[model samples]
Target: MIVFFLAIAILITIKIIWVLCATSGQGSFDREKKEIIRRANYLTSMVCTSPQGLLDEMPSGIGEQFQGEWALYTCSMTSAALANIAILYPPNKELSIKFIDQIIDIAMSEEIREYDKLRWREDPMDGIYGNLSHISYYSHLAWMISRYKQIGGDGKYDDLYHSLCKAMNRRIRKSKSLNLPTYPGEYIYIPDMLVAIVALANYSSQYEGKYSTTVDMWVERAKKEWIDKETGLVASFLEAYNDSVQIVLPVKGSYSALNCYYLSLVDSEFAKEQYDCLMKNYKQGFPFAGLKEYHDRTCLFGMDIDAGPIIFNLSPSGTAFTIGCAASLDDMEFRNKLLKTAEIGGSTVTWFGKSHYLLANLALVGEAIVLAMRTSAPQTRMRNK
Candidate 1:
């Protein structure tokens, strides 16, 4: 009788934990895709309603130094999220156009314009070039404009688009590291290298040139120097010129997953090799789902700015973003598994007719990844009208 009653108590305890941990709608994970879409739209709306207004609402719990540079990284997330929404989802002409135009406004300028009460970082290089040209801030804005303009049939942004592209090219041509330092004098971050490569590739495709040659060289350089001998994965930080490893990230899943995703956009074959290596080494299976973050002793080394709350070395942010990567790479199984993990981690809250993430909120970047995952699948893309 004691054993029987103990079994019942244990089952009740498990059910309660599941309820508290899981999201709404039967509080289940796998079936929460629609909720994911709604949550994504909420983040998109934060941009759509005001465009540059996100800057106004800065100073959210993160450190002051990071909050100052919020505009720089958020711009990339905003463009990637909004561009897909405008292109693939049902057209919200007014909303998408306003968002795209504001992105153009930032892209065409020397620096993001000072909003009434915002605290954007004002470093000397804060102009259109940002921290470095190769890690060009304008590149993302340009790509977003180009994609939206193609879809929206408005030549309104054409000049600005070309100008931003030229800005990126100018910076690339003058850069010494080929990829410049992520910080003015600091080391180069591999993820930024992936972004710079995509930006260049997108520009070349639109204008037609063999940009692949440069990409090929960058890939070879990384493989030859940045990759660790023990593990076939990239070191997180590398010397800009010689590509020597400054910091070995080891097989940390949060970075490897994103690094895998971004690298794929520029060089699919190489990115695939990286992705395969990451999965073989870092992908961790749980009872409910899988995580893409680190599982080794390297997990003890303390988290970086991007890796949020590294419990057991599994970052909520990294695992969340990998969902979009999986969708882009057409790995639906992994994508769904990651979504389940997200759902379990995030809770559903609605306000003003939109879903917002609360209780372990995934933040803007994670929500952006959710949008990318939904839109990247062919079925969700806006039909070319």
Candidate 2:
């Protein structure tokens, strides 16, 4: 027993040292590039094996619609992560682009879109020129294509990209609250709407500022109406009806962190302000340095699918998404600390030249989010412009 304990201690110490060295930002780019390739390869193989597989042991109570949504998230997030890897490490560009294309095609397929189609009774792409309220689906699709274009992929999806941007922009421009529903009649998730804006911003930059005015107006208006004064972070859910906006769930750290990360793509100054506010209000030091799910530490907020499991006042999604925000804003110290925390908690294992999180039930999804977030450098978008 003593010998086993000592061996475990030695391994833990070695891991801590490894994390420190990796985050030192000196000659780490090569290491990161290699790591991205490994993770990307794992994701590519897993998705290729079963593009729409659910978690290993999902609850029997969950229906097919939720299962489809989960699969869609896995596909889109993985593709986006691979796209980032393609941009950050030029050598992996061709293979990464191929992987992204494959995953994104799955995301757009009928198997993935069945849930949206079931809800709306039509194909998601059918209303490309109309108010298709599937913001999450279309925004992720558009963002993936934008990233694909950034890395010199062929223009096969150029028309789809333009139509998505035009549709989202038209909806936002005509809305009273300057936001669109994530679903047909559901409330607006600020993070999802921000993604639509980011997609439009990227599209506008590529073109000649065609949707620039719409993106600019939404950002200006959101700064006034979307911010929660108490936490000074973006509200997670809001309902727009009867020509008025009602805040549903306020001060969600997970959504706020995600919104800031998306905002960094277009508005650095505004994103920085929200990032600072998030650090001040939601950042926690003990029991793993991460963001709390809710602003009030004393308040008990439990696990949810969106925020993941919250343990000891720490939120998994909030912490993971903040990694991307920190990298985007160039906050290296905090980024390194978060990276250290993830290394300590994620139970990462590298085998056969591929890496994954043993602790994550949705291991591929977690790996995808982390790879995309950890590689969130400014050059991903800045150079393209």
Candidate 3:
């Protein structure tokens, strides 16, 4: 018993040292941008070279069903990281555009869309032409294209972008609840839908309110039904079966932070509301801090695929993504602290002009997400206050 306690104390002390010394420059725009560029260099090369080979390194624990979904997500995150850096650091825009184009080619390939195809029983792009059923795949694709444009890319993808925007708007208009599913089933994860909503909102802002009504209606419905009354954080998932909506998971940090990050892009005020609720309720620990996976802190919900590993009440996904929310919300203190925690826990390493978390390199998606979150910046809200 004494040895176990001593071990814990030692580990905490070491973590503190790592935070203070090793990652002292984390969270700064230059530092974060330089780091993201390194990882982007690595990920872009890997993704453009052998996307399938990159998938081979994915953590098998996330399950086979999600393997392809994660592959798509990894490229999406890598592209987002590049796009953010391009905007935040102008000198890199040309290179970032090139990298984004390469990633898009792979992301839109049949190989990457196979997972969604298998589940929804149709090509994701074709589904977009038909019903927009695969929200996860197509929404992310739309988001990447949106970012590509924001970073000064030529309108090379305008046709595909317009098709996605029209399809998403149509899907939202037709849905009884103004939300769509990640898959073909009744399950509607609000975070995924929020990504699509943000994409639509982005399109609307540039196109004279084309989907503004759809975006506003979804926001109104979410505020009314999707947020947990007690916690104020958005519900994680809803079942839209039989034209009725039911919350399946209530106020999870992993999804809430992700939702807030996406929401900040289009609705800063409401995003701030949910962001405050998330920090107040889910954030745990001290000098080595992170957000909890569950709302009820006392419960021992050990681990899950989305939340990753839960340790001493801190969740990996929750903590990592909260960095994004903090970045978008301009909570520098919180963002830097989490950045420190990430360095300590992630075993960050820089080698051969490339930077990546040594531990996270085991799973490319984790590294991709960290790059995306760390580089994310606040955006102008699409709606008038």
Candidate 4:
């Protein structure tokens, strides 16, 4: 049910990301896999065709308008999808190359470069990463660049990778939990931090011993921040180290599942344990297995930005995302069931000659996730050659 409400609420800040408990089977295994891939192709193509004309700018400090995270999220998402395409969907190699060109164009286009020069929000000083947004936005770029390199990307982006990781390395050192300050406060998004960790992992692959241990250290600290004390499921947000229900926000399937998506890549054993926990807690059976956005405590509340409309507490975003997790765990039983549900529920749609979801058409990130799930190991693939 990864229903991404385009332009209203960010669909998913995937990096596409998590759970359903249903064990029902409605379609053949082969049919479900084909549908999932068909949908993945549609979604990824839509991203490649997404217009890059006017930047979606939002209010910054005072009067600025380039502070929103959408564009940057799109960048991370597309690149992540490219990573999936190269590593997981080998049949689409020729097509993936074309999408790679489109993504690079988006990043290096005259419009994007000009926007960075004049309007891109940054610190007053000339320091490359003086502004937190500069660091925040570019960390994913580091992850993307690293993944792009695995697929034989030209060395043109090598410098960009170093620059983005350099700034993020500083942030990793400064933050207590290695959570880069997306807004200079404890308010942090888990996926962003996870992406930076993957970036560091990629850097370590090149340098050998430098960033590997740091990624491990950060994972240890992050477990405390992300996991719920009672349910043992991942939380949507963390206020502090304390585990009080008040401080530990309710476990929402959207964020929780999204965490598992990247977390599986960062710490698979841990991610598997939490994914199992999530299936126990957040996933519900509507006479069939589907996932709820919030746990029972917060189920009555209205939908948040991440968790879209909750139909019987079944979060489309959460349910859809968990397909990737199920795929990672090789839980084909659950994965196929969820795929059948997503299709029967009519989430996939065709519009303007493009295929996407109806609930939240900008399923760009969510759909990209569908592609990533196809891989047995969803971690970043490091190429030594």
Candidate 5:
């Protein structure tokens, strides 16, 4: 009984600290923006690039398999990292251009060419195939086309983007199992759907009226398939082989963040629902409190570089990635909470009187804040008008 009471007290104390740190109105971290840029640039430089510009896999200390056709995962991180860098420091146009150029070169490489040639055997047949690997590739490519259009390298990239969209569409059409396009076979999972929706949406944005209907259809399908009405959180996947699309239960810590981030793009009701669900279900325990892995009955907690280190019982990687998504979505409350959590979790390391994680988080946070402020700022009228 004494131990239980002590645990309760600890939880309460942590929550209080989180609230205080998050709600502090001075925006104490804003001044650290330059450091943030430097750190992000450093990290980006380390994880990405070979002589040819293709992204290399970060060493997988966790259970993540880097050897498979899943080599595409690195590109996804590169896309998100590059997009974040562009958003934070637009002045560094040359660096951004270089990164994008590298990515394009990699996509057009013999390795990718070889993968494309053998995709039939190597790929999953269900619509849900390719999982995170494919999703990362497509999402990064789409984001580059949509968000970083100014850094256009050559007409070849435009063609590449269009070709990718056409290929995805062809895959969807071939998997005629569902009324809406499935992944490859019958797999209608959440992550795949999220990536597909974002890719389609980005492509449609480029073409405007030309692909608007297609974009809308994919978004609606995501809404109908992945979202759980009861919990308001999106499920991980819908099993293809099952008679009915089996909805996996218990929302994932990482999925919550990714779902919210993706939803911000289309501004669908599903996004709002997922956000609300995240707020409702988030517990103060785990990394902020004391656990490493976020294990529950439905989802098992494990370490993957993408999922981050699972400490105590919480997945740090998931939390960090989720924080990025939350920031991208402009959820100030969640963003603040995530920032505070990072502070407590040792995500922000101090070196020579300078904070590391805080710098990275601030850059990301600044981008989100600036985007939100700009969008919400009241319009001013010119005197002449």
Candidate 6:
């Protein structure tokens, strides 16, 4: 049987060579994926920025006007686009800096200020205005600025960041009911507290030594109150009654996105809890089966512009955005599954192509991929011993 043994050894040698060749070829495959992502990023950036830059028709009016809301969304879209670009392509430092300036300019423009005042009242066309109380606008602005700072936009927007943090803190304090801030009460549905938390976290990261206590207090309270113990997910709202805080029912994809944001501020344990809960209940074909398919079920059903169109039993917004965060944390299985879901969902666009789909889709996908890359990359953490 010596010949039989020799034959087996020869086959094993061939297999080893095949594996080596495959391993060596991985660089080319990675280059290809990078190129695809780069192209997608370029496409998304153009779609988000071009509409406003090229528009010759500027809307007229001051506060609570249709023109003001349009400008707000436009600026919001531009800010999101620039943030995604900055994260994805660190090499494009000049472009990112310019975009940050553009975003700030847009925010400071006469039109936004007028609209800012209208947020608390009702307008003729748009109904109630200023429901987000500058928190939403400033949160996005803070995010863009923080990203810029992370990518070397230092000392440029420090004052703006400080102003935004103070404004947000004041609003939060004013809105707090029974120690838990009630966000947007009735007129708007956007999760303002989550946005505020993310913005505060970025600010804290920037000035940790100086603002450690303040940051810690906010982060700790958010972790304790907002996070749901049973599901390990953060609820959208809290009802205040007799100095007691009660969790609001019917969690949503928007809240899922916020969970990722909140997790970024906390430690790995919090993230793991959220990940386990999402996989067990929110994902398709898990213990919470048919959630991805149900459209009318408020708790699980998806199809908002912010959430994007859920298709084939999947929450596009929830899955796509979370994948990047999961990837950054080295949750390979979740990342891979999320990437697959995005590929499947992203490929189904037929109407306005990628440009017609909401700007968040592209922005979220790009950010997720970039965050995944960052999580995988090695880094030195500066710890005070």
Note the clash tally of each candidate: 4, 0, 0, 9, 21, 3
Q: Cα deviation of 83 in candidate 2 (Å)?
A: 2.4
Query: What's model 6's overall lDDT?
Result: 0.49
User: TM-scores of all models?
Assistant: 0.75, 0.89, 0.91, 0.74, 0.67, 0.65
- Candidate 1: which stretches are off by over 4 Å? 1-37, 49-53, 59-61, 90-95, 103-136, 210-212, 241-251, 292-295, 298-303, 359-362, 378-385
**Candidate 6: how large is its RMSD?**
10.9
Error of 6 at 115 (Å): 6.3
The sequence of per-residue lDDT tens digits that candidate 3 reaches over residues 1-385 is 9999999999989877765766766757866566677777777766665656656667776665588878888888888888887777778899999988888877888777888888888888777779747888878888888888877788899999999888888888888988788876557888899888988887886678888888888888888888777788778889876787888866688988898888888778999998989978888876368888776755444867788877777888889999999888888788988888888778766778777777766677888888798777766421110
Q: Write the per-residue lDDT of candidate 6 for residues 1-385, one digit (tens) a residue.
A: 9999999999878755644432232222133244334434443354234334412123232223444444554454345444444444555556756765665665555545455455444321232132245555566567666656765665877887787776666555555431323223542232555555666766777776444445466556656776766566766556765555577765665456546534544445665666566666566744222224222353334355445465555665566546534543556555554444343333322233222123333343333332233232111121110
Candidate 5 lDDT over residue span 1-385, tens digit each: 9999999999989867765653353232354355455545544553345522332332333222332223444444454455545554556556766766665455445454334234333432232234222443454455555545533334556765775666565555444322222223544446545665567666775676545565576566656775667656666556654334566555566666566666666654556567666655643443363212233432344464334555555655455555545554555455555556655654344344333444333233322222222121111110111
lDDT of each: 0.58, 0.77, 0.80, 0.59, 0.49, 0.49
Model 2 per-residue lDDT tens digits across residues 1-385: 9999999999989988876654554233455666667777777777754444533222334576766666676776776777677767777789877877777677777777777778877688886766657777788889888878877788989988988888888778788888878776787888888888988998998898889998898889878887787877777889987997877865788889999998998899999999999999999998678888887755444777777778888888889999899988888677777877777777566789886666545445666677778878764454663
Error of 1 at 150 (Å): 4.7
RMSD for each of the candidates: 5.5, 3.2, 3.1, 8.6, 7.9, 10.9
The 10-residue segment with the lowest total lDDT in model 1:
111-120
TM-score, candidate number 1: 0.75
Of candidate 6, the 10-residue stretch with the lowest lDDT total is 376-385
Query: In angstroms, what RMSD does candidate 5 have relative to the true structure?
Result: 7.9
Q: Is candidate 3 or candidate 4 better by TM-score?
A: 3
Clashing pairs in 3: none
Q: Top lDDT: which candidate number?
A: 3
Clashing pairs in 4: 1-316, 1-317, 1-320, 2-316, 2-317, 4-11, 18-321, 18-322, 22-289
* Candidate 5 residue runs with Cα over 4 Å from true position: 1-32, 51-57, 60-71, 107-139, 150-154, 173-188, 241-244, 283-309, 343-385
The residue-by-residue lDDT of candidate 4 on 1-385, one tens digit each, is 3354553345333211211221122233344344445554665555555335323322233122232344445555656665565555466655665666566556544444433344334431244566354444466657767767666566777776777777777767765555544554455566666777878877887766567877888878766655678778655655434322223466678777777877776678988888888898887767446677867654543665455556667787788678778766667778766766665454455444444445324434445554455443434332211
